[model samples]
Target: MGIYKPKTYMVMISNVEPSTIHEAMTIPSWNQAVNDELQALIQNHTWDLVPVPTNRSLVGCKWLFKIKKNSDGCVARNKVRLVAQGFFQAARLDYHATFSPVVKANTVHQILTLVVSRKWKLQQVDVNNAFLNGDLA
Candidate 1:
């Protein structure tokens, strides 16, 4: 019989630090905003959240966090987003229809004018990275 040998083991770690007390307190509030955005995206049918299945193709998402800052060097808030790994998707399988529509600045201006004339509260949201939420597979 051949000589017995023990298998080696390795542990990998990320080069990031844990949240501080200040950050810990602040993070949850920002995460709430992120969660709201994610929910809206789901409700709007922007993307589908599915399990990575075998023998078929699917994209993946990951949650990315970034600390936002104002020009005055103060921490504004934490921004989180979901992003897709688009490279893995097969073009033929994913791109059933490639029709896309574009809006000109004049159209946007008209819409804004209409909103203002209607005196409606126009709430705009800023989705940060918006492509990295979970793992691909």
Candidate 2:
């Protein structure tokens, strides 16, 4: 029998996410990503950049960076978002207790598996910061 050699593999990774706006501004792709985030915020009317009010606590904002990958483990796009710190206010003072539920990864995987097996068309909706649609029981 002929000897079988193991295949040599080396993954080339280039999609490191920038941690700060300054870092993101240096790269063309990251800069475009940041611009996209700003446009979305403005289009959605998420918030207004007004002067800081006197004696009022203002929450800090930061940018979060992520690289979207394709099913073949290839870099598809760069995603950037502005997020609030959300930790300056005390409980019940800012606006009662805060609670937000999100979908889990495993559950998403199962749903995707079933859809793929049944050859169903897939549609996705980004529910980030989605307001309450009904009364919470």
Candidate 3:
């Protein structure tokens, strides 16, 4: 028997899904990395996947990929994400608690006014993938 070197395919954004068509083509290393990430998201409970239940709503997921570019249009990074199509989901059934702090406009205004009066510097910071920090109930 002869040794075989696996053929690779390139992922092209087109009318058909890259995975379905990949059998007839070669997949590039970059595309494989993106695919692997998508798989891990499912395995790691990033989102729960279930079949469409009768008399109930279901959320659909889509694969998203983008190539970050510099000002000169040169490729800098590759980002891949699997996101839910929110339209298919019902608020109470799909997502009941957002866990985001609820602050009224009046409350925000009052806080800002107090901050200004105290001459304190206002600062804002964001945590990346904050949802991942929470434990799954």
Among these predictions, the greatest TM-score belongs to: 2
> How many clashes (backbone N, Cα, C below 3 Å) per candidate?
12, 0, 6
By lDDT, the best candidate is 2
- Taken over the whole model, the C-alpha lDDT of each candidate is 0.53, 0.68, 0.51
Estimate, for each residue in 86-114, the C-alpha lDDT of model 2 and write its tens digit: 77667657643333333465655777888
Worst 10 residues of 1 by lDDT: 11-20
What candidate 2 gets wrong by more than 4 Å, as runs, is 1-14, 95-137
Question: What ordering of candidates by lDDT runs from best to worst?
Answer: 2, 1, 3
lDDT of 1: 0.53
Q: What is the full ranking by TM-score, best candidate first? A: 2, 1, 3
- List, residue by residue over 8-60, the lDDT tens digit for candidate 3: 65544323234332431354544664666656665556655456667665555
State which candidate, 1 or 3, has the greater lDDT: 1
| Models, CA RMSD each | 19.9, 8.5, 13.5
Off by over 4 Å in 3: 1-26, 39-43, 48-55, 90-131, 135-137
Give the per-residue lDDT digits (tens) of candidate 1, residues 1-137.
99999995542322232244334334556546567667766765665456766656655555555666668965565555555556666677765322222334555576678889999888863434333343322
